[model samples]
Structures are given as C-alpha cells and as structure tokens.
Target: MREARMSAIGKGLRRRGRLMAQAVSPPRRNPDADPGSGPAPDPSWTAPIAPRLVPSPVFVLSSVRSGSTLLRVLLNSHSRIRAPHEMHLRTLHVRLSRSFSADAMRELDLDRAELEHLLWDRVLHLELTRSGKDVIVDKTPPNTLIWPRLHRCWPDARFVLLLRHPGAVVASLTERRQDPNPAAVRAEVLDYAERLDEARTHLNPHVITYEDLTADPEGVTRGLCDRLGVDWEPAMLDYGAQDHGTFRPQLGDWSETIRSGRVRPARTATPGVELPPRLRELAKAWGYPEEDTPTP
Candidate 1:
C-alpha cells in the first residue's frame, strides 16, 4: 500500500539519519544528566532528505466567530470536500519561515516558500488519509492574516472568505469570554479585511456572509458549492444527519457546535460588550446593518 511504503521510507530515512549523525558526532548522552554539556549537533538533518511535493486546493478565510465552523461542517459534509478542523496553519508558516537567512535557506536546500508548500503537503496528506477525502480546505481563520504568505506558497489556491457582522462576531467572542479584548478583536478584523482586499486582487475569493448563511442555509450553501466547483448533494442540506463519529478533533470554541453536528442561528446579544464605532464601520462596508441603520 502507498501508506505502508511511505511509512517504510520514513523509517529507513530516519535510521540512516541516526547512522550519519553517529558518524559525524560521538554517541548522544541524555541532556538532563549532562546539564553542563550541550546537546548533540545533527546539522545534516536540517534539510529534508526526500523529494518535495505539496498542494493547496482551498483555504477558508475569516475572523473569529464568523460562522466558519458552521461553514466547515457544511462543506465537509459534501461528498468531495474535506474541510477539517482548524489547524492554525499560520503558526506552522511562522515556525517554518522563522529562521531563514539566505545562507541558512541554502543549507536547508529549500527556501522558506518551498518549505511552506512541503509542510502543507505533509500535513494535508496525513489529514486526507485519516479523513479518507480527496481535497483539503484549511479552515483556520487566522490564516487570513497571512494571505500574502499563502499566495506566495500556493498562488493557485482558492479562498473562501467567511464574513459575519463585526457586532455579531464580537458578541460571540464576548459571550465566550475569551482572553482577547474586544478592541483586539476589532483590530484583527480590520487587518483581516485589509488582507482580504489584497487577496481579492490576486485570487477570486468567494464571499459568504454569516447572516445570509443563517437566513437561507440551502441557497447560500448551494451557491458556495457552485463557486467551489462541486455538485451539491441534498444530504449536505441536513447538517446534523451525518455522523462524523468520534474522529476529527475540532479545536477552539468551534468544537462545541461542530460536535453537535447542527447549524443554529446566531443570537443577537452577549453580556458586557457593546458595538463599537469601528466595528460599525466594518459592518457597513461589508453591507451588514450599521448600528443606526435598521435592516431594510
């Protein structure tokens, strides 16, 4: 099987790496016991010992609490789409690109961009194997903050921008009582919008509003399917009907709703938070009702 071959190849490479490390350096001692001594140096292990291949088919971009979880469940329900739980891949991007000087990049035999693509392939291949799906849709909202990096790594990657009223998104965050302050959330939304604009100039990202998704589930989802180039199955209609079983761990506040396997309308208010003027501006720009403007 392909999986077995990959597993065997990985183990063989690791074994060879250990042998090479032994050749270059003395046998390793436990770092804890040798506190005065430094750790063993395995410099050759820095670069990948195998050929690189990776693909990025889809990316779901959004602000926090922008109904991304619901959209993910809807898309993941489709026969061909596999929108997995949030991986916060922006962190992965950060780590892989964190220490790249031109010299270091050359030593690693991959520039930061190539490393990012290879990592996407590495992670997605494992994820696809587990989910038994053909396509990958990275659903982490923070990834929107790194749109340019994503574009550099996977220029052909399609985007789905999940838009929600800034008020509603802030309300949800406030309700959850997460560590992020309301001001911080607003600023993050503003930056996400800025990056969204930049991304639009390059890639045609499909925009899906949270209110519309809640108001007309089927119509919104069907349109989304058309944009994504996948046929809409009626089973995608009943979000709760499918049993995803006890696999695919959902992270963050999303875990609760996604675990329920259902779609619910957003509630209007949350405790101890009011709509700020900046968010109101954002809402207006996104064509949502401003604080003073009543719904038509």
Candidate 2:
C-alpha cells in the first residue's frame, strides 16, 4: 500500500511539473511560421478596404430592340472599351430608394447613402475586372427610365441616348411580345421617351438615331468616340463574335444571334411578314417609310 501511494504521488508531481512548465513557457508559434514569428495578422483586419476608384462608366440608355445591343457590341469591339449588356444598376437604385421610404423597411438598415456607396462599390468592382481599359459602357435598356438618377450618380459620366421611331419600337415589342405586360411597356416607353427628352434639356446628352446607326455604323461610332473621347476601333463593327457570357440569362436569345457576327440592317425585307396598320402608322411617325415596312 505504501509503494502504491508513493507511485501515485510521483505521477501527481510529474503532472504538476508539466502544468508549471506550460504556464511559464510562452505559447508555441504556428508550425508553418518561422520560429521567431508571432501571430500572422489578417490583411484586412484593420477595416474593410474600398476597391480602387475608377472613372464612372459611360451609360447607354434606350428603348428595347432599338439597336442598343448593336451599339454595345460595336463599342465593346474597341480594344480600349468594355461594354456589357443592360446592368440595370439605376433601376436597382430606384427600387432601393423606394424601399427605404416604406416604414416597414425602416429597420432594414437601408438608406440612400448606403445604397449609393454600395452601387459605387459594385460599379468599381466591375470596372476593376476591366482594368486597363479606357472606357466601360453600361448598356442597360431600361436605364432610359432613370436618366436623372444616373446623371446624379455620375455627373461627369457621358450618356448616349439611342432614338428609334416609336412605331418601330412598338412594332418590335408587339411582334416579339417581349414585354409581358403590354400596357406597362407602352406607358413606360412613352413616359421614358418624354422624360429622356426632358433630361436632355438639362444634361445635353449625345443622341444617336437607329436609322443613322444602321446606315453608317462606323461613321456614327466614330462620331460617338470623338464625343466620348474614345478612339474609333473597327472592331466595334465586327463585335458580333465577342463573347458576352457574363450577361444575365434573362436577356433572351438575342446575344446568340449577335454572336454570329452579322450587322445586317435592322429592318430586313422578309417576305410574308405583315405588320398591322396601327404599327405601320407608328413606324411612319418614327420616319420609317410605310411601303418598305417589314412584315411582322
């Protein structure tokens, strides 16, 4: 019994000694670190770092099916330019702003300044991906509806407004049934066009018509480049081959057609496609000749 008691006491002493040694010794450094190294601090442990600032992107606003895609493709052909499909960033801002006005949304921590900063950060991140490019174009179609907000967001950023005959626009919309809500699309287009005109009075944005773009893409693009201070690139005309894999999937099969690298006239003389009379009248108002109107 005495021997067993002594053995227990010896084990206890060894354990106590180990405890004392552990308490006195400094903690071991990370095995991956050098012997003298201390804790490796996180690169972002100080604060959330903001992305490097870039110039605000040029915004193209226009009605759907109005050659905005063609312009975007053409502009993107320039080695110095990166044009992506309709990002609808301005629309997001509008929705966020509206959300903040609701009392129920008060607790969501959303506000104008926060939303603006968030959008700025998002845009900056996008710009960084196109780093080294001279210009980035946001080719959002519905962005035409929020021109004022876009102008306010980037006062110095250039705006390119694409004009199509409302008749052509309405005809295209009716044929494609692209707008799920026809009434809403009609109202939105009319309101957006009027608002665009109003905004131009104050902002003096560059306006290019679909007719001009289709007739002389290179010339119009050159002029646009001059106005926007970008160099004219022949690649813009052949931009159909460029990959647009990053655009949102909801954009439809149009991108696939654009990828085929064709810049045919917008109004093809397809046989047997009869356009309704109302659409013909609408097209006429927008300067499309009644006789040459492509069948729907």
Candidate 3:
C-alpha cells in the first residue's frame, strides 16, 4: 500500500514538473505566422473579417512573354500592394452568366453587374485583407483583352500596361517551345497589345515598359505608385526577401518569377522564326523598332 502511494506521488510530481517546464519555456509559434502577430491569415476568411472597398483595384495588363511575371514580382513587393498571380478572369462573364438571373439577383440586393462585382469583390478583398494590404493587383495578361468586361464590372479600377518589345516577347515564347505554330502565338501577342492600345481611348491607363521594369525597377515602380495613389516602399525592390507562397501561377508560366534576387536586364536571344508583317506594324505602334527577317 505504501509503495502504491509513493508511486502516485512520484507520478504527480513528474506531471507538475512537466507543467512547470512548459510554463518556463516560451510557446513555439506557427511558422506561417507573421512575427508578433497572433496568427497567419487564411486567404479565404479575410474578406468577411475586414471587407475591403477595392476603390482602386489594379490590373497588370500585358502580352505573354512580356516579362509580366517580373513586373508582378516587383509591384507585389510594394508595401500596399497585394499582387497575386493571374486569377484567369478572362472568362469571368461566361462563368458568372450561367447563374445570373434578374429576379434571383434582385432578391439578394444585387443587379447583374452588382452580382458579378460582388462575386469578384469577395475574391479580391479576400486577397487584400489576407495580405494586410490595401491595393489588389491582379496580374493576368489575358485580362487586357477583356478590358470592356472589367470596365463594366469595375468602372473605377485602374490598369497598368506592361509593354515589351514584340520581337523580344515573340522570341521568348518561341524559346519556351510550348506552342507549335509561331504565327498563331504572335497573333495572340499582337491581339493583346492592340486591345490595350484601343482600351486607352476611354481610360487613363498607365503604361510601363518591361525594359524599364527590368533596368530601372525602382524608378518605374515609384512612378507606378504615383499613378496608383500609393506611397512607394523600398521593400518593393527587395522582393527577393518576401514570402510568395500565396501567389498563383498565370497561364502556366509563373516559373519565370522563381528568380531569387533583384530584377535583371532583358535576355538577348536570336529568334529563328520570322515575325509576321502585322507584328512589325505592332512593334511600331508599341514604340519598338522593327527587326529584319528571321535567320535561317
């Protein structure tokens, strides 16, 4: 009986010692948490916790291979910017239209347009609040082709056209070797650029040269901040140091953004395929010098 009682005392003392040890040692923090903050935010819940107005939502418009990812990394590094990778908003209407009904929408205090914005705003605001940022920059190149849809859904939204030399863009795409028909790929590139050129007619869209973004990231990003009505932070230039886990891939090519350090100059390449005649005209339209025939 005495031995049994002594064993009970021994177990209680061990339990109390463990409790005291745990109390003495600081609690381990979740790796996902921001230092000094309670917990890391879940991207899905931030919208309802702190609904953002999205008064000045930003879109990064560009043609594929225009160094859009590079621009995304730089701009997203800004203090107030929450630039997630492409959300593929090109078919936002087609997807939303299936469920759109006037009578049903009215019951929820929304019209057709409001319903679309409500659905989109939920996603955008969640992204912003999750990052604890004010500006939401959706970096989707195809979104430029659907300016009309965006303008209708968000009349106050802002745009940044990231332009690169069409020849450079074409060369980059061809090098990727993803698509077979170079001609078709060039047409898609020209189409996106032309749409932005036309979209400028009704909106005060800001243009940023991809060449400038790579060569002079700070100067160009600061100019973008001025246009965006937000203060520029040096942290933007330090994108290499930030966490990009929440960022999504765009058009299956966010791999370019895996660079670890500051921006680099445009990569020089000898493109073998000849650019179409229309591409030369577009080069001129976009302020890039025309190039000669493709090398055999």
Candidate 4:
C-alpha cells in the first residue's frame, strides 16, 4: 500500500511539472492551423524611428554682377541643397553694428552666448524654414568682404567664390545710371578681389571663374561639387527654369540684371567706365583683357 502511495505521489508531481511548463512556454501552432489565426500581430509592420535633421550651410561670396545668381541657381538644383538669392543678412549685420552705440557693441562682445542664441534661434531658424532646404546657402556678394567674421561665426562653413573679369564687372556696373557710386563700386571690386586672395590663404575656399562656368558649366560644377564634398547632380545645370521672382529694392539698378536670366559674355573691356587709375592698374595686374579705347 505504501509503495502504491509513493508511485501516485510521484505521478502527481510529474503532472504538476508538465502544467507549469505549459503555462510558461509559448503555444506552438499546429502545422495545419488556419493562415490568419495568429495569437499576436507581427512587429515588423510597426512604424520606424524618426530620422535626424541635417545641417547644411553653404555660402557664395562674390562681387555684384559676377555671376553669383547663376551659381546660386546651379547649387539650388541639388536635391539636398537650398540656394537662395542674397539674404543680405551679413549686410544687415554690418549696418546694425555700425548703428550700434559703443556700449551696445561692448555688450554684444561680452554676451556672445545671447548673441548666438538670437542669431541661430531667431534669424537662421526662420530662414531655414522659409528656404525649404536641408542646407541653407547665402549668396550675398558683399559677404566676401566679411568672410573673416563669417568664418568666426561658422567655422565649418564652406565657401564658393565666383570670379569674373574685373573689366566686365566694371563695364556692367558703369552701364547702370542709378549706381550710387560707379567709381566706388570699381574700387570696392578691386579691393574685394585683393581681400579675397588674402582670405584664401586663411581658408580652403573653392574658386569658380565666370568664364569657365559659362563655357563648361557641367565640368565646372562637377569640380565644385567635388571640392565642396557634395554629389554632382545634373539638375543643377538646368536651374534657370525655376523662378526667383522680383529682385529686392536694395539691389538698386542691378535689379534689372538680376531679373533677366542672362549671363553676359566677357569681351574686350570698353573705356568711358571711369574706373580709377589704381583700379585699372589692379585690373591689368589681374590679367584682364585690355580695354578697347574708342577712336577720338
């Protein structure tokens, strides 16, 4: 009778062990089970994690009428890039600095964190959204003069400098009747060119000659892409199809030139532009074609 009781006890223990295993283990489906009869939905169909945003900051520096717009259009063609017409933020910054009191200027220097916060949070954030780009490209020509400050603000920023024949730039500026200071523009161009050369020594900037860009846009643009560490997209060559709308009032008489999507050809420089002698000397030194003097 005792042996019989021991056997019954062992059997009960084994039964309990089996029940516990069934409770902890996942249910196995029958091979012939219905196709749609699953206990839980597959996890693969769930939504994925959000992607991180990219920060692209591209700047084009050049003199007015130096094919800066063309370059901007080309860059804007890139799917990942956003190249907008001159935001003139740097210009505004310069104007603001000039108008600020000495005490205010000191405060700006002392409050670097606050200043950066205002610039990035208030100004650049709005610009990025308005531009509709993963990367923002500022194509302000005069910004070339303030590159040192720009570099300080954005150390990792890349630069594209559009170079044109000094003579052609002078001729184009002179033809505008409303040019505030034609002579001053000429002087500024020369000075800026020199400054650009000097700044180049301090930064690894890419230079794109206007003539080369016009003649072989694809090759030049490809080269620029390589230098800028961006992929070369064919769309960039046909960016003129996009409309840029009306030019800004601050563009002055050059507004007409900006509206017209024409790239003027470089030819022999003509006289009567009244470029200062020093500027003329710099133009010659820069190897610009000789001016075509009209017969007296």
Listed per model in order, the count of residue pairs whose N, CA or C atoms clash below 3 Å is 0, 4, 0, 0
lDDT of 2 by residue, 1-296 (tens): 99999999999999999999999999875654443433333333222222324545687877776778778778877887877666656545424323224333234444454456467647755664765676788777777777776665565778887877665665566666654576655555566566556655677778888878888888999999998887787777877567755543445227455556777666643344355555455456545666656544
* TM-score against native, each model: 0.69, 0.63, 0.72, 0.63
Off by over 4 Å in 4: 1-56, 91-122, 130-132, 179-182, 251-268, 271-296
Q: Which candidate has the highest TM-score of all?
A: 3
Clashes of 2: 4
lDDT of 1 by residue, 77-134 (tens): 8888887778777666623322224345657676555676677768877877777777
Off by over 4 Å in 2: 1-52, 91-111, 178-185, 246-249, 252-257, 268-296
Error of 4 at 118 (Å): 4.6
Flag regions of model 1 displaced more than 4 Å: 1-56, 93-109, 178-182, 197-202, 243-257, 268-277, 291-296
**Per-residue lDDT over 1-296 for candidate 4, one digit per residue giving the tens place of the 0 to 100 score:** 99999999999999999999999998886645454422332333322211112233667777776777777777777876777656666534322222223235344342333244245424555766777766677787777888886665565778877777666677766655374676577676778777666666677778777877888888998998887677998877766566554456454224544455554444445665555565555555545655532222
**Which candidate number maximizes lDDT?**
3
- Winner on TM-score (1 vs 4): 1
lDDT of 3 at 77: 81
lDDT by residue (tens digit), candidate 3, 1-296: 99999999999999999999999999886755543423332334221112326766888778887877777777778777887777876555412232224445445555544555666777787888999988888878888888887776676889888887777777777777765577777777779768877775567889878887878888998899999888988888888798655443444344544555567787633456566677666667766654533423
RMSD of each: 12.7, 11.7, 14.1, 21.2
- Candidate 3 — which pairs collide? none
Ranking by lDDT: 3, 1, 2, 4
Better of 3 and 4 by TM-score: 3
